[model samples]
Target: MGQLQLEEELGKGNYGTVKRVLHKPTNVYMAMKEIRLELDEAKLNGIIMELDILHRAAAPEIVDFYGAFFIESCVYYCMEHMDAGSMDKLEAEGVPEDVLGRIAGAMVRGLKFLKDEMQIIHRDVKPTNVLVNTKGQVKLCDFGVSGQLEKSLAKTNIGCQSYMAPERIKGESTGNLGTYTVSSDVWSLGLAMIEMGLGHYPYPPETYANVFAQLTAIVHGDAPELPEERFSESARDFVSRCLHKLPGSRATYAQLLSHPYLVEDRNRDVDMVGWVKRALESRAEKQVQQQRERNQQVLEQQQQGYQP
Candidate 1:
């Protein structure tokens, strides 16, 4: 809009592109998500749903929503710009146990707020949806696929397939994907925690021959857990409570907050700001290295062409 100046593109996904922008009047930096409108009703509904949730979700652990506007065919909504970026980008070398516990606590509190206050379930609970800043605050974002709990269950199987729980995957395979409880999100949280702690997805699809094989493994194989060698007993126990194959046995948001791992985290001082700074520096270095490799490859190709 007239009051905002676009700075740079933050990220792009299937639905839209997010860009860094500055609000002229307020002189504040914000991340603006621009979703192009199409004739598809479902897509429009998703946009509307996200806006609705953003406007209503006012919690410390959730991203702060600014304002939204419609221009031409695109709908742009602004939110708090998390300078440090998402957790997925920072987990390359794996997160420390103390830092992980703090991050997990924020995520659980945010998800709990959505369910209890807004009557919504964050269908997509992954590292990428969790954002952090220099202030050491971790918040949840990207609620486009979030669903309303109907009779303690959400009937839709819409979310990142890789992060889907075993029971949810089984439901999809059998064509009996009627409904999944909130505990499904707990499974995702557990998986995401392991991924953050290990610096990669716990169930790497590359290990399997195909997508079906991977899904089958998730449905039938043992639930993944944090390695005992790397993480403490309390941390492992918290994750185990989340990765339970049976949804009924999984820990609730309240229980997760009360867990000894998180309880201990409350007393300990974790250096999230230092961690984020180092992670960003590492990411920048990796990008530079990748660019150098690409340039070298192009130069080699050029030399080969010249020889002929």
Candidate 2:
């Protein structure tokens, strides 16, 4: 159990406080999340399962778990230091529509990677669990509650109430009534994106239960209200598809990447491909300008020395 000097408290959650740490040997910055595993054998098994799932889900858009170790009754996990912070921080700053779409695109890509490539269900896909790097690229984190989908319709009681699918709330004994599957994660993702777009989680109700009730209504009733045509029709359509009550009817991850919203946004509007290309072009042009200046400096030096 190596102890690194904790500089400042980065954030807090149900598990415990995460702090900024300086790895004594490498002198590199990292976020150390201190969590306790005080569970019995069954519960401990669940934690191990989560770790296994995260280990196999090696995606760039998924936060890299550097290492994990235990020290005197507590377990700690080290991860990359996301200097830009979480999506919650971004929401606080009130991101613009273009930026929101970019975030959404990054999130979708990460989820798609998990679902299509790794065959894992995040279970939790809210903004609070999404980390943003300095480049504004979003990565999905927090696999503590995620698991593998056993069937098209699943019955489970894991996940935040606000983001839980309608089927998950039904009686467990009803068996398939809770037939929410990996697509439920997509639903949560859509809701989270909408929250990012609006700068709020869209539950104006008084209590947490009220928030659940509101979500239940939307899940069963009419679609949620829009933001005065703020989102593109394609984006809206993708969201609608994600929130569909029937798990089988929801679009898969591959379908989501090829979705008109993501396709058009990346090809024509603001998105990762366009942003990265522009950044590379800008960097190349700057390098060329610098080279020209350096060549001029060398020529001047040569001319100045020749007269002497």
Error of 1 at 179 (Å): 1.8
lDDT of model number 1: 0.85
Estimate the lDDT of model 2: 0.68
Clashes of each: 0, 1
CA lDDT of each prediction against the hidden true structure: 0.85, 0.68
In the order shown, the candidates' Cα RMSDs to the true structure are: 3.4, 14.0
Give candidate 1 misplaced runs (Cα > 4 Å).
Answer: 39-50, 144-161, 173-177
After best superposition, candidate 2 residue 270: deviation in angstroms? Answer: 4.4
Candidate 2 clash pair list: 154-179
178-238, model 2: which lDDT tens digit per residue? 4657877877877787777776766545543654466566557654533655766766787
lDDT winner among the candidates? 1
Locate the minimum summed-lDDT window of 10 residues in model 2: 149-158
